[model samples]
Target: MPSRRQVLALLAALPAVLGLPEEARAAEPDVTAGPDWDATDIAVLKGVLAAVYGPNSDRCDAVEALTASFAWLDGERKALVRMLPSLFDQASRVLVPTISAFHDLDPVQQQACVDDWAASPLAFRRQIFGALRQLLLAHAYADPATWPDIDYPGPWLGRYELPIHPLRFGDPELP
Candidate 1:
């Protein structure tokens, strides 16, 4: 076994080596939760957003987008989503032992936590990271404010007014 000094050195390097930040939380990042999401879920979602995007990403209306996102889900899926916060917390306990939830950690720490999961050895964890990332992109990018960042000039509704092609999937009379 390693000596005490070696263990302390390891602990100091834990954040970078393990992707769990050791810095104190400077401030709480602002994020809006939908009516369907409880505070805990919202917190976890905020942590995810900070990790995927920058910590200061506050332009997009997360609440509105998530509300619509959840509306399309079936009851079973919604229940599963509702339980994700606790699940994330339980899994992340090793990283931030003092914190009750993943979001309780500082943004830097939260990002570290997300990074850990994204690169986790477990396939399940990697899948969870992908799902969270895709979910954020789905809703966050839907907001017009984020369109410029991704060079997405919103949807093309003018397709109805002017046909880009003679044969379209939605158009009738296609053989």
Candidate 2:
């Protein structure tokens, strides 16, 4: 039979093996998420701006593509956070105007607009790109997976039933 000391020693070593205590681990060199913003995930916002309004502007298409590509990332960030209400507000503002503008254009004109925007000089693309980066950065920090299940936004498709038996409550008397 193993001695008590041996068991205790093994148990002590178990944490090391499993990496149970995160703080005890040796520090790793911090790496930025990407080239665009800054050390604190701000760069993600910057990258979005760069892709959009930079010298080769693709602000219209790039914003849409970036948002679409990061659909999963959106879930990671969740919809409403208190601290970033202003930032979210800003994004909402841009999205509203841009979405309105996009819809207003005829289909062919919209396509041409996007194509033209994509081909624009890099400088102009930066305008809307930063907001995109902010979105991605927020998602990483917020970790939307931890959010609780919420009812669907607009409405429920079907009726909800209470668990009580029908007999528990007598049917309404005929008028």
Candidate number achieving the greatest TM-score relative to the actual structure: 1
Query: For model 1, what is the alpha-carbon lDDT of residue 30?
Result: 16
Instruction: Kindly report which residue stretches of model 2 are placed more than 4 angstroms away from their true locations once superposed.
Output: 1-71, 74-100, 124-175
Q: Please give the distance, in angstroms, between residue 39's alpha carbon in candidate 2 and its true position after superposition.
A: 35
lDDT value for model 2: 0.39
Question: Model 2, 56-172: lDDT tens per residue?
Answer: 332224333333444333332433221232342243334433443432444444344444444446553433333444554443324323222322233233456546566655678
For candidate 1, the 10 contiguous residues with the lowest summed lDDT are 24-33
Point to the candidate with the largest lDDT: 1
Question: Which residue runs of candidate 1 sit more than 4 Å off their true CA positions?
Answer: 1-35, 95-100, 158-175
Q: Kindly provide the TM-score of model 1 when superposed on the true structure, using C-alpha atoms.
A: 0.63
TM-score of candidate 2 on Cα atoms, chains taken together: 0.21
**TM-scores, one per candidate:** 0.63, 0.21
lDDT of 2 at 151: 28
Per-prediction backbone clash count? 0, 24
